[model samples]
Target chain A: MTNGSLSEIYAKAAYPLLGHGKRNVQVLKEALEQYEGELDSDMYGSGKVIESFQVKMADILGKEAAVFFPSGTMAQQIALRIWSDDQGSKKVAYHPTSHLEIHEQDGLKELHHLEPTLLADRTRPVLLQDLREMEETPACVLLELPQREIGGQLPEYAELEAMSAFCRERGIKLHLDGARLFEVLPYYGKTAQEVCALFDSVYISVYKGIGGVAGAILAGDVGFAEQSKIWKRRHGGDLISLYPYILAADYYMEKRLPLMGRYYEEAKELAAYYNGCHALKTIPRVPVSNMFHVHSDLDKEQLEAAILEATRETGVGFASSIREREGGGCYYEVSIGDRYAEVPQNALQQAFQALGRKLRHTAEL
Target chain B: MTNGSLSEIYAKAAYPLLGHGKRNVQVLKEALEQYEGELDSDMYGSGKVIESFQVKMADILGKEAAVFFPSGTMAQQIALRIWSDDQGSKKVAYHPTSHLEIHEQDGLKELHHLEPTLLADRTRPVLLQDLREMEETPACVLLELPQREIGGQLPEYAELEAMSAFCRERGIKLHLDGARLFEVLPYYGKTAQEVCALFDSVYISVYKGIGGVAGAILAGDVGFAEQSKIWKRRHGGDLISLYPYILAADYYMEKRLPLMGRYYEEAKELAAYYNGCHALKTIPRVPVSNMFHVHSDLDKEQLEAAILEATRETGVGFASSIREREGGGCYYEVSIGDRYAEVPQNALQQAFQALGRKLRHTAEL
Candidate 1:
């Protein structure tokens, strides 16, 4: 069955553990109730709703200023471009699977004419040693904390500090692709400001962990923030009224920031359960944040059937579909959020038991 | 007083002759009530809400496809860039006062590396003769309907047909900066499709005359529309959830499209009122669309005081603020909309009469 059909089935399951729920107009409706002041839409990224959220985010991230953008892709690209322009170098560096490199269709290269050096192996996070060993130093070094492609894996905090120092000493700008920044805070044992202190610029996604509609905040020194606003207008990220996004972001950030620790705990708990299943293991073996990827030795179709069987029996679904590996296995990403807590403990236990049985039987066959 | 304070006064007036009303959360709330189907938010510019709207707009504009954008600036830039790329030329042409040349911080130059040759003098539309005399042939030519910078003026339909035929004969792409496309339909006595047929691509603003929160639609042939989507993602115009914009756009277009003829009529009537006042006259001496500019020989401060005085006495407001001319005069733009209908005729007459007396006295000073 297609992923769409699988989602339909999973959506009807008694216990669904993906996101808060469907992202719909109701999402905005629920968030709007939280706002008490004038809902005056922000005009070209100005006014109270947008400006207040920018200020709050900047303060939370301990930056001099922040600007909201329509996407993390735009914010991060502009962050690197600004740094590259200042350093008079066109080269920036990130992991091989960096969103800019993979997801953005070479927007940086095409739009900004910025060249990127892939600093690390695709399977792991870029460490301080990688920066030190690189043949050519880039103007900016982007570190995606909880590097998403490798299943929310983050380099050690000390390693990040070392890299930050190295970049600063070498006059290289260090930028954070912190799309899941808040999710990793519980594991890092630090506040958002503390983690952000190590980076010259930080780009955070409001929709990812905060469960808002889509938008991002790029925070840095006042000059960087000012430059980003100009770039934002150029990129058309300055929607005349971004208050819908700002309102949803402000409401959800307030509601979800306090629960990040719980989500992280739940991710670890869920990963442990997956590891107990037959032919299944999670990347990192344990989650460093509220997200992880579950891998299976069986191919995608086999795992899909097995998961479908288990979900049908237990009324507790896993993912809608799985991605096939190059040679053999399959995998799917899991992100723990508010819905994870709603899954009944007994039902989850029963679901895992069924999943384990189905995988084992499928393997034997 | 600042424009912000003036807006406060105008907002409170009994006969506010501007937009429908305050653009707040209520605008969205009212629009959401109109949607009957699934309110699922579009994911990365896909799904039923976004797709259906794109299809509807493309049909309305008589194009093979269309793409929704966060801003008209982004849409038009990408449209021109695509045509330039296809034609294997780096040069485009537009009116000197085109939004690209004056407002966008030279994004076309900075991002796309496309050079723009300004074709027309700032005071009028770019006619066929202007294109013929341009020193070099550009890959694309942009025309902004109502030529906003010159007070919402337009060339004759035959002149537009000539321009289109000239561009097509020479294999040059013609792009319409149709921000106020609907507003001009009544004057042209043509459907949106009929007008759009003359151009290879058209970009329409959702918020300007449609009274939506904010968004834009770029409509063209299938291939052009597809290429625009890639450029959109590169520019980060593809927000994760654009349902809020889509809902408002759909709702407001339906609510306002039928009223375009009425708004156009009201605009002409309003221009006459301005022209009748001492030292006050509208550009074109009449309106060709639902929008026009009212200029005064008096200075900005003088006009502001006169406007404030008239507004206070008659409870009818004209504009929040006036823009000073290069040397002496001052002007303000007015676009007729739903709010204009609510303005009592007697009050408008009295307001203008009082405005004329105040202007006559101010000019004598």
Candidate 2:
């Protein structure tokens, strides 16, 4: 095939996440336009986009400076390394469900050469008592905002404040894994800056809710970020051109950030909708953000097939999976985003109605 | 603008790079296509493309297996880390200008927790004596082919063979930073397999010459690569949907690999063309591969302006400046690639003519 045909095929196949949506397309287009006519090459050092993204992130988080990285793992690992170096300690304290501990394949130990002191029984939220109980004082403590693996539960504001103060008093640096920071903002009754101020450093993802291509920005004081840039390049996060991601992030922030509150409100209503349904049961009585899980009596394979079929029929998308619950029935998460938020309440009701019909059919069979 | 318009803009801007250009784009496209419909999000456990890429790379390098990484830095660092762990030593020996020493921001020390024992000698290639003279016994030694920061020079085949044998005798693993190994092949009068066979692990870039979107493949024994995959996820190298890179690499191998021999010949001819000219001097006497540096007596600012103007006039690209030589002259590298090789000999001659004219004009003023 010709280059044009091949590119079309590649685009269609590769960018499955991009669909025929005005909002998604507009966000990406604006980003491309903003950065189209520039070299943006890092002739002297780091690329221009990376530099600007870092600066912007730092300012937003009320930090002195920031650095853009290709992946959150590199950023978090480097952060731990710097903390360890500063404190002259090779051990870090964090909850068991922290991305660094669970997701990063023991990179903190294997790559960074640091030992993790995992705090067990963090099913609710981390507290100062938990920090006080540690036998060995760690160089740094990692806290995740609205923990992911455990259904997005966050600690109370007073407890979080106490934890931060305790770390500060003990000369321990606090690092926040704000992967879903935006989602946590409304729930905590705080702004990004307000929440980030409690930590020495913050790492945010541009691709998650912000809907950028793929990149991360780690924000911290000038000294910290400068050091982080060196680590960034060391980890091979530095690229020749990063304007695409930077521009996409800028566009997404402008377009989608304002709608985050709406997403939260919609999520609450959706959770309430599921709670009232007979076939479906809500996991967390109240969602912390725009995400919650639903328990259902339907079979896994049958539920997945039905959801896929129903989405095709109704043009409304919902995740379908029978996840084994803590008690008895299976559960699957229902995450509401800007896309789902735009669907009218009546349309969502209709989707649930279709889901009910499908579940009943599976039950009868 | 609409999403269609946005995609069109992205396509236009990214077309040259990602199009079927017989470069990295082809490889990335191929990789993405292979895992087209799979939605496996995790890059650590049961990584999507790493296992397959490793298998393919191992076969290409004549190794037992291979590992996939997000960056060459991580791959090389992990290789050294594993070597150190196996040998129960923290020190590794490498040339002063090796990528691990200079480019990676001391990641071997900070991230991998390895001590680099530099084998320094600006005058000649590293020999067995250099390795023996090291105060500490290193766990491994790194050898970079066509050393990048040093104008792409290589050690003689006899010297390389001796070094390998010495390492073998000492029970030290040898690692090759083959970032530009493809460029080094014709110069050494050897194939990739022959060079790679001397090393325990090899790291190659898919983006550099192979022309993928962004990726590196670490080839080694099957067991070694399997372990590296776990490390890869820890480093955040595991990406979602790597089929694009795989496809692009497959296509680039088919189209660009055949042209490299011709590129080598043309680069030599180009170097000779500059050597005979009075206005410009070729460094290193002869071109080893498709890259060489040209030393000019012209002022740095004037030279940069002239090169920029020449690019606008001829639509041919060249790096403005690499660094200043010790002998009061500015140096610029000319990389002969698919694009550079396509320029006619006359156009190449004209570019030089344009440079001279701009310099003379500046002198008159």
Candidate 3:
């Protein structure tokens, strides 16, 4: 809600595939009300429906137990706090670009009073070399799937395994900020459980890719999950009833989890089309997930207006608003979803073509 | 979710009122769907309806601003942490029965590292002598209105004023855990703002007396309230959308807040009826809020079974489960609400008569 971000996000919510927005009321209402089973009691975020979803998530993620929370920020923070407490170290490692470091306003430091050991370069995954270079041991190493900050790029599997081994050999905790875990699972070519086995705890977003209304599931061993619930209650994320989010997540996970491979392929196709343009470039020539970013030389506001106008005129939402990048460049993310997959690539290409001509015309004007 | 508390709570939720429950789904659904106004944009706890409710709450509490949270546990903990950080001291004083101390799983200490300076007796409100006897300065003094743990007991307004003045002179913050603020306001015969004027900050439960499904409002000066939003985000209290809770809170506050006086009177009438019983006792003898406990000489489980059986036998539900009190007494809370408000006193008295008979029979068996 800062600096009118809520209103800005609200403004964007009016567009479908608003560059991958997960929440919409009509969509959510239909998703929720269509449930045929009993609307289970919403007590402490547990019930047959809520627990079923949580267990399925744990099974998929290959963890022993799981708990749902109102937000991932709370889940990730709690996971870190639990690991720190268990390992008896207040220091934890995460990329500078990690959601906890950037979006959470230094919650790890201010709220938990924990020291953060910044690991690796911000542009990519945490390499083993980064762990070797740290001055002091951290209680946990936090990893985000596909490194959302830099266009959903992930390191090679062997590289991640070495990083895991590095942390394991030192008896440090391994945690995953898997907000987009489902989106990037295809890149690993392994089951979520298989990928998750290397980590001590994993936090999955319900709304991001799975298209639940809003919530998260943190998976780990029973003890860790139990501790996370306590932390969740303490942090206010222990909502009285999480049925709406849980039921929605269950439906969406079942609906969307299987489509990730196609979405990933669509991302590549979309990125290939975007890169063919003279002024737009995809950060990773190939997307490691169902998402990629299009860095544009065009002005951000202008590009957003053009894309939005094109969306309205042609019903082809090529992208959402453009985010101005550092060093005077502007970019917008392209997250391929079921909604985005519905539009023909030719329709998107035409929208981009019109956008380029419109930008050229604006330059002429 | 602690020590299977969630499961236990869930088990209790199967029956209406669990003897001290706050919300239900059918009621919530009807209340939510009947809302005729346009659904506000799902934002970070703000919108026309949400902000309007927040501003109205601030006005009612005599504070500069108010922010809504999904849970009171989060609101109070964040409120304490904020006051502690602002004063540069972590030690905070409260009665042993304060929600933060008893129910929050040491979040104030574990998450915020704030030292709790326990004060006063658990069975009664904090007196001036308690503050006078403090060994060291504290960052804040937390008080719960008509303390829920003690069947909603409140100190004399003058005593509270003295305590507030003592903290004011010492530059200590005074935070009120007013989870049932509305339910108790009639006892003081003061408006919410007038009574709230004594405290530096106050947290009111939207779900408890107001009948919303779940959420809380932490009210304070402009700076404190503004800072709370940041803390809320950090703690994962800031959800993508809190419109449901906010809208429900708005509707319930409007529908239920004005009934406090009548409910307060009803509680007195009900307590008078119960105190007239042979073995059952209303702790305060007179009502302080719309709630009080009925302590009985019978066994806890036997009393609970009798009440449930009575509820099942008669269409009227007169009471809820009894909690075994300290010193071998069994007790249960009677929180008067829309459902309980409808039952006549005669019906309730007869139910108790039947309960006594049932208990006697069980004793004989």
Candidate 4:
């Protein structure tokens, strides 16, 4: 039998559990089917469609206003830049593994000429103590809940409150990188508004856990939102028409938000299956959100082969690819969503058994 | 009888003589229906959807590579930044009315820290003489063909060739702001590639003159295009999915590109009708493209009322809005496209007649 790439193999499977579904135009088509709003396109962020979505997001986040951006990268950078400009300090602080520091090609530094201060070690979530210990005062402090790079880990709500208060007391603006905000809410037992209330500004990805095609919402006070509009134009985030994104964001938020709790439960169960394997374990030993990292003592090639074997035999796909760990072994992030619940229980059990068997063989080596 | 705003009245008319049609989701719906390509979403500017379109655009522009951006603002700025960085110069030059200088909230200045030198007076297109007269050598010179702000006027092709040679000889990178590139091609008797040949880099707006929802293509050498990808991500122009824009761009370019000559002819005929009226005259006195500005001796209220009366009576919409001229009177830009030809010839004549009669009555005052 021919061996295809894992993603190719997963794509052909009966139950490929990951995200809401495949990233395709079908996602947009499905979202459009659910959309009951206006058909008119927005012009450079104007008109009813973009405005209504912005208003809805702002209300849900309990901010005075909100602006929609084409990407979370632009939204987050502009949010920090605005705060930095207002404070007359160019320094901003965030976790070492923050999207700005890693993913954005130093846009914050190169484009905006703002200095970024990495707050803590890359392996853990930033704590309140990390803020208090900073030698230099930053214009803004950014916190990404369910720290994605480290494996979707989040600090306690009480700890978040203390950090928020500490930042507020020191006249530092706090911004939330809530790209996977909805995924973390079930664990916090807080509404999006309650969680957002702790930060001066918040940016959320509509495309991440929400299963929208692509877009983001940046929420803050009236003035901040207004300023973001100008920056949106400057960044070219203000496309002539953003209604498709707005519609999809609106549709998916409605469809999947209520299922966050269920997805969280599914994630825990799935992680347990992985842990049952001889060489496999999950980071944090428990998931705080609907996503967690599955690590294996086996190298990437061995882990991939085992997952592929399980997927092909039982028709239950695990992951498309695995990342090599710094020390040794391999890992992959498991993000639970609509697809997770659709995996047949019996097939899932068989797939895990197959995976366990392969790992047992590897452990014997 | 209750009187509505001119745009409100125009929107209700049977033949709104501007653009391909309405700017709505239906544009996307129609484009999607015509698309026979892959439905897979591009993840952060990867995948076949975006890649194929970029390749197609690069081929059409005769460039080694191309990059798609959410807006022309981002594409143009990045193009200029790359040129400036390569030349180790921060100064770039463009027409006084360039979109980068006027419409982009000083993004080039603020984000990239590039200095802009306005090359010529706002009322006219930049001449080669103007380039020769400049004291300081700029890293790049941006030339907007059929410059939108000055009523879509263009310099002679020979002048363009001369400027291109002079810039090349002086180590100044020449960039084309070809937002309305297709509209001017009929007049220049040049293919897009031929026109783009003079410049080191080129940017085109798919939305304007092409009637896509929104997007821009920046094309140049392979290395330049590769660097733009990084800048695109930095500016957040690299959205998770841009297939909708790509599909629409592809669909409309196929539909409308060959019809540029027809639109150009219609524009001239329409401009003649305006000039025939007592108080109306078109900028250029003769249109060199599918777009031109219609100036009226009448004030804003007078002009709007007269057009509103003609639109309501004849069901042939002229314009939705008018802008006040610097000193006095008012004017509006007419961009002829699919909708212009759809207007019945007889109805168009009568509409202009009504417009002329109203202007004559006002002139009697």
Candidate 4 structure quality by residue, lDDT tens digits, A312-337: 89999898878888889889989998
DockQ of each: 0.63, 0.23, 0.44, 0.63
Residues A224-250, model 3: lDDT tens digits: 988888888788777777666676788
List the global CA lDDT of all models: 0.90, 0.68, 0.77, 0.90
Which residue pairs does candidate 3 place in steric collision? Answer: none
Least accurate 10 contiguous residues by lDDT in model 2 chain B: B14-23
Better structure of 2 and 4 per lDDT: 4
After TM-score superposition, the amount by which residue B151's alpha carbon in candidate 3 deviates from its true location, in angstroms, is: 1.1
What does candidate 2's lDDT look like per residue over A289-354, in tens digits? 766667676655555656555555565656523356555555666666655645666666776787
Off by over 4 Å in 1: A36-38, B1-5, B36-38
Worst 10 contiguous positions by lDDT, candidate 4 chain B: B29-38
What TM-score goes with each of the models?
0.98, 0.79, 0.90, 0.98
TM-score of model 1 (CA atoms): 0.98
Number of clashing pairs per prediction, in order: 0, 23, 0, 0
Worst 10 residues of 1 chain A by lDDT: A32-41
Query: Candidate 4, DockQ to 2 decimals?
Result: 0.63
